[model samples]
Target: MFTKEKEFFSILFEAVSEGVIVVNTQQNIVATNQSAENMFGYNKKELETAPLIQLIPKNYHHNHHTYVNGFMKKNESRQMGVGRDLFGIKKNGDIFPVEVGLNPFTVRGETFVMALVVDITLRKQHQDQIQELNAKLEQKVIERTKELSEAVNKLKEVNAELDDENKKRLKAENKAKEALKKEKELNELKTKFLSLVSHEFKTPLSGILTSAMLLSKYKLEEQQQRRDKHIKTITDKVHYLNNILNDFLSIEKLERGKIQYNPSQFKISKVVNEVIYNANMMLKDGQIINYPENIDNYSIYQDEKIVELALSNLVYNAIKYSSENTVIDIKIKQNLDSTTFIVEDNGIGIPEKDQKNIFKRYYRAENALLTQGTGIGLNIVKSHLENLKGNIYFNSKENQGTTFWFSLPNKYQTKL
Candidate 1:
């Protein structure tokens, strides 16, 4: 029974990607999964029967023991190393940073604690480097002691060099900041995705489920047509679900740096036609897409798929935000060195304050808070256009309308 129980739980325990270590009431490491073993550079055999303190830094041992005893006496579990930093010692005696979460459990009248450990060395290093850079920049200004007139004249060049250095340092720091910012964006994306899926997908999936269930009750020939209607609804809802999944998949590809530009020569009209064709299914009653004239004869050398995506998103946004019977205008124009696409709509324009964050992933304006959207469409559009060496901007008035315009370089290039 003991072996069976262990085997049953081993799957779940190992399934956790983070390192997990189990320690007895005496703080002796009793068992550890592969992640824990690998993280600390210690095997299961080596970890078993070893004092837990061996894994922690020597300087923290006293406080660690006191905290453990207090936790034991309380018979409750709380987060370990809260309000302060924590360090872990690897098998090779090299100390590294870690974040630990502790939970206490009892089995067979004996109490044991489980620790979930995450190695945060990279996070710590980035933090330290940013701090060091900031400190150096501050020290440079504080150490200047010459008179103001002479210093301003003589040190102007040095200050300019320092300014350049500061910019380089800031650029490097922004990389780290981008990582953290992306993490926050992803977390917020999950929330928005869940909300969207719950509200948007649920309705369609519920329709599919309901239609499938209702179809079984029909047996006569007269009911066959009704059953066919339900089947069509199911099929269309399934297709909608596929599109939702595709959007999420695109986000995953973007995050993983797997989206490569595969630009090819294609006619601009082809992109607009495909976008409008696919988007026609989603149009509201009396809604119309006004296609620009003379577009079909135009040619451009760019990624047709990307242009289709951006145009589709903008058109959909126009439709979703505008009331029934509104016209969405699409205009394509070519200048001396670039081709521009404009999507204009008489919809509820974005608020001025929200314009700055319109391209931020999962950011929705106050006026659009209750609107049915994932808030990732513009972000994806902007990202794709930027990758294709294009620029996007918009002009909007709160009650009037919005005109989104973007231009791509007019370069003849074959597929990469």
Candidate 2:
């Protein structure tokens, strides 16, 4: 029965997870379990004489001694895992996290301290791993912030470049506009110079031509052919000079708003015939003039002189711009309350982009630059037609042909 009781108590002490040790007030270990021997790296026989301070790290030995002395003086119990971090030194001199509990007891007038110690190394390792991960996460966040800052800076640089490009574009556009305005002023000056020269020369030129014609009547028979040739030269020169003078004078009057319109009744057929006859004089040898047969004998109320000038300008332009031996078509028709005049030509047509400004003063189609023109012909025609409450329009295809149309009121038309 005694062996059974001793075996039961030994089994109970050895089975405890905590290492247990009992020490006297002198700090020498009096009793210990198998767990305590294994925890402190001491055999049961060695533990009998071992000092309790042997289980403490060298750095913590003095403090532990002081605490134990104080606890013994107060005769109180102490708990572990509350006041400070506690660690123990193993036989291998390796330090490990631990929790220590102390209980003081008196039996038979002998004082002893019961100590319970647990290994906490696994918990401490877990805490350390979490701390390490948190530090790594914080570092990653800092790197990401740096990347974002760099991206924002690059975006700012791009925006700056765009702003600079916009400024340059605007400057280039302004410079181009200024250049266009200066070119327009220069063209106006050239037109004025041509007008002045033509005006000063036309009167003398006409007088010379007339005198030459009169001289033709009384000529030596031997020199008669020479006289005829000279007369023809003078007439041609006068005719060319008259055309130049007329273009200039028309532009000047239109600019000064001095064109007078006298609307009157005129035979449409007679006017059409006269214009056709004049146009034929300038046609190439094989070029044909097609006129509508039997145009309506409608008496149109409009400025006869202005209408005739406008028609002549259109026919002359058609002949000037077309290839040699090409056909020019003229048609006149009477509508219910209006008269229509159409001039069609197979020529180098105005470009689509330039057609809008074709009627503007001083504006010429790019294709018409080689032709001798002041660019004021269509502008004058538009003004004269407006005064008579008429409308004029044109259709053209580049490299194909052009067709121009004008509609005048058959009678006196009101404000359009």
Candidate 3:
């Protein structure tokens, strides 16, 4: 029966496609399948009882014993040579890449290890071919990525133009026709506003792109200041774009009657500080904001977000219309029924004729038509204020300056 069992083992082992070699505790080859003998360029019975090192590359011989000893102690099955390449030597001394799996077992109180080996030269060659193909395609991949980015930017610009046109068309259709002359004036304004929109978007987008390109050139530690300058330009451009988008959204909400005011008690200083912090980023050379005095103790029981938005529009407008080396003053006056916030700037102000229509939607002053503005911020602010029992008013003189002020009720009583 023992002889029959040994014969059965031999038959099964030899049937395996991979090379198999069994080693004793002394690291001598105890048995080998025909596949192992053929793989190592040896005849039948040639590898029996030979040192396992005879089949390993010469450089690996020094550490082979330690590895076998560790594997024997662990006495488990696992793949050999993880995270590294392994090689085998043939009987004629030809070296080739190989993958190896090891299994430890015991028979008749003797410990032995079985090594399963597979030649991997073909797999290694395939991997090298794939890497070479990737290297050749790298430049094409980069060009394609750049083309995709430019296409996306162009799409954004087209979409913005379309959105502005749609808004204008909708507004014109909704308005009551006072006279044919007024309708003709409205059409002319729409055309001019469309041109302004194009200029406004393209100008900042071009600045952002230029700044971004310049930023990549300033890579050295010593060029940090240059990098920061470009970074600031990008940031300011992005902020301006965001404000325009917010203004559009505000217009849409107002037209749809979807504005919802959520009232909550909040410190007035908190809102003031945020507005000044953001405004500081847009300050011209030698310009400064004169922050309101000692309002840290004041609180407001109204819609904090609306108040902040109204304040931000006024402060931003003051900054935009102001000149270099100027001061913008912000003052807060709290009373029993309402609180008034003031933003005064020494810059281009509304013309006497444009002052009456300043709060009208999409109305830019004749003197300020060339400036970068959407002309909807004040309209949105006024609408929000009146809806919440507040009021907004301003005083201006052409070529002098402007002071815009808005007041909100101390405790808002919902009208909707």
Candidate 4:
């Protein structure tokens, strides 16, 4: 019956897929299944009585004795090396990874250790392959990242270079535009200056020459009245020429920054009466200039001469442009902060297209070509008034009338 039970167990152990290795307390292999033999590269029934160390690597023989003695002393059954990997040796001196479960039992009053061994060579090889592939993949990713970083750096450098170039190009363009504008302004000044000198001098010189020639014919003492008329005409022409020269001189001083401005407190009505008295000298037949009644007592603190020049220019324009029997109205309005001077005339009004350019240097309205003017009065007045912190604007309708309004800040400082 004992033999029958042993045969039954051997058959049962042989059917297991894992190798069943049985060892005595002395660590000698007492029994091994066919699976154990096959796992260690052994033939059938060839592993009996072999020292268990023979199946371990030569380097692991001393450790195996300690492990077996510890296991026997502990008298507990468990897996070998629970938290670590295990290694195994084959009959042909080959080493491979393994997993081991140990069982201890007393069979017929003898102690024995049963080791359940699984040859995990293929699993270890697959793990090694996976680790190698992962290492290669990691290296590739690092290289690719480096290349992308380099590319991004290069793109940034290129963009920086492009921005610098764009800024330089914009600066060059702005410089060119400024240069062109200055050159155009210079050319315009030259052309208009020549035109003004030619027109102004030619008319006055012709008048003086004509009057002198007529006065030469009236040399007899009885022609005194006729000679006096010619003398008066000559005097007026000389005065007109002198006024033109003064306008040119003012422009030169303005350009050279040499004009001196003096600010003082002056009564508005005083300035008004003075300007109206002078403007009355140039009034035509049946024409009259009417100022508002009871002018305000506001005392403006500003360059009184500039205000006079501006007002004189406006009233002079009104008297020169209007027809006979037309009434020119001078209106004055004062706010708390500013003073307004309005000169309204029923005259040959400015053309719509000509009004915008009326204040430009040497600009004359086409309708006023026959009139006696050098076209410098309004521009000079405008510049002087601006220096005094004032502004001028006008309203006009063709063949109807013209109204010019200029404003002055009640409080201002002289700009030297």
Candidate 5:
């Protein structure tokens, strides 16, 4: 019965998943189960007289000996699984991972240690592979985070650059605006200076021209006749200079707010006739003036001097620019609300691009450059019209000629 019980216990030990190794107090292996033999790749007979260290990895064997000695000194049951990296050696001397449980037993007054070991190689291998995969995943996360940070930094840099560019552009635009304003002021000053110079020179020039022209017609000796002819040439030059000066002076007075208006009831036709007579003196040879006969009886209320000056400027400009022998038409149309004066001439018309600026002080068209002018005639006319609470407009085409029309409100008669 005891032999049968022994055989049953041995079979049970061999059936266990753990490898069972029994060692005496001297640390030599005395018995081992079939599982132990298989775990270490040893036969049952070969395990006899083997030291426990023989199955341990060489690096761990020394520390294991110290632990076993401590256990023997204490004479207490001590566990081996805690705080250790367990290892076992195969019959071929290959070391692998293991888990060990040690238990002590006293049999017949002799102490023995029973070590239950489990092969943990496959579990450890799976754990290592999992760790490697986790490490790779962590590395990828770090790389992605770095890339995102770089992209955000780049966007911030670009935004800062754009803001700087916008500020620069705004500064440039402000500078350009300031420059344009300065240019405009300079232009106004130039116009004022030219006007002043022309005014100061006109009166003496007109006197010299009139005197020379009168002297030219006198009966004189041969030497005197030659002198008279020279004087006449000077007269012509002075007359031309006087006209330019007059235009400038008129523009200056208008721009300087020095022109005064004395409004009164007057015959509009008389003013028109007087302007036509004055303009005839400057007309080119063979130029004719045509006036509307019906205007003789029309009356208007306005500043007579200012209106006459305005009409004279327009009529003179028309005759000066028209072709010789071309007929200029002057017409008057009176309505219940206003009076319209139309001056039409067969003159070289203003270019389309220059027409808008024609009334601007000192602005001259490209085609009108050869025509002697101070570039102030239309500006004077515009100023006079504006002062009278009237307005002027014109139409022209290149080479086709021009017509100017202005209207004064009849209500001014009561207002004045």
Candidate 6:
């Protein structure tokens, strides 16, 4: 009966998936399960009665001995490697992460420890990957915030210079006071812009962070769809943030008179096709871009980049503010000396009260308050067109639709 019982215990020990190792007071591994043998790349004959240090890395031998001695003295059951990383070594001299639980026992007045060991290499890798991702995201946020803060500080310095100039013009007291008032108003507007920037950046960043965290949790092959979803979210948010930064850069350049327009001859069809192709990606469900009819023959002599930017901004805005299944019409008309491009959308239209300030920097219609926009795209477009001797105008009614058209000289003549 005793032999049968011993066999049953051996069978049960071998059945455990986790590696089990039994070490005697002398720190020799007196017994181990099949799992333990396989885990450490050893056989029963080689592992039994072997020094426990053989299964541990050379650097950890001293600490392992000390820990073994302390545990023997306490003679209690507890987990090992608490609050720290633990590792194990294989017979082939390969090191790997591990989790170990120790239980003290005695047979015939001889104390021993039975350690339940688990290989945690995969878990460790996942944890390290998450930490790296988090660090990268934090660094990106820090850099972007620093850039915006520097811009604000530069504005402040400019305002200070203006204040000094106003003070020196004492004879124009009324004008000086008016200038200070305008400065105060401008500062308030800056404050509002900062707040808007924070909100716009924070919302997408939070989404990105959340998606990243969720993406790490899905590791199975069947979870590919979920992973793809989070990846797309990250991609889209990054793109949006990039566009916002571009808008900020454009604003800075326009203010500093740094933009240099280079005109060239290009087919208008090429620009229109490119814009439509990009817009197709951002289209809502059931939405379609109706291509302008017979525009392959049309060509223009203008700054291709500027024209592309303006057209892309208008088309993207039309897609953004419009509903699913709605059509955005791009109508082109060439006249005697000028060509006009019209973007008409049957979406949420601008309020009548907001029409006058539609092209003003940082102004948004009341109905568009909920939309994701910096309200600077139109302003930038308007500035670019006006600088090139072009004009932009729009017609809209609340809840109906908006039609925006801009005219450029057919053959732009460089002022000599």
Model 3 over residues 90-186: C-alpha lDDT tens digits? 9899998999999998877889898998988899889888888887688678888889998899889899889999888877866645456678987
lDDT for position 85 in model 2: 94
Model 4 RMSD in angstroms: 6.6
Candidates 1 and 5 compared by lDDT, better number: 1
Task: Find the candidate with the highest TM-score and give its number.
Answer: 4
Candidate 6 lDDT score relative to the true structure: 0.89
Which 10-residue window in model 5 sums to the lowest lDDT? 196-205
lDDT of 1 by residue, 50-143 (tens): 9999999788887888888888878766777889889999989999999988888888888988899999999999999999998987776566
Candidate 2 residues 233-283, lDDT tens each?
677667767776677687788668777667788888778778889888888
Q: How far in Å is the alpha carbon of 394 misplaced in model 1?
A: 1.5
Clashes in model 5: which pairs? none
In model 1, the runs with Cα more than 4 Å from the true position are 1-186, 412-416
Q: Among these predicted structures, which one has the highest lDDT?
A: 6
> Which order, best to worst by TM-score?
4, 6, 1, 3, 5, 2
| TM-score between model 3 and native | 0.53
**C-alpha TM-scores of all predictions:** 0.54, 0.48, 0.53, 0.70, 0.49, 0.57
lDDT of 4 by residue, 15-94 (tens): 89999998999898878888899899986457778888878887777778888999998878999988978888888888
> Please, what's the RMSD in Å of model 1?
41.4
User: TM-score of the candidate numbered 1?
Assistant: 0.54
Question: Which candidate would rank higher by lDDT, 4 or 6?
Answer: 6
| Tens-digit lDDT track of model 5 for 1-416 | 12545676588777888999988877898788888999999997898788888888778766877888777667666557588677788989988888887788776677888888888899999999999999999999999999999999999999999999999999999999999998997888687656645653554566676766667576557568667666866766776677766676776776687776777888888888788777777788999999777876789777888778777777888887888989999888988989888889989989999988999766779997766566777787777777777899999998989999988886563212
Stretches of candidate 2 above 4 Å error? 1-230, 413-416
Give the lDDT of residue 281 in candidate 5. Answer: 74
* RMSD (CA, angstroms), candidate 5: 14.9
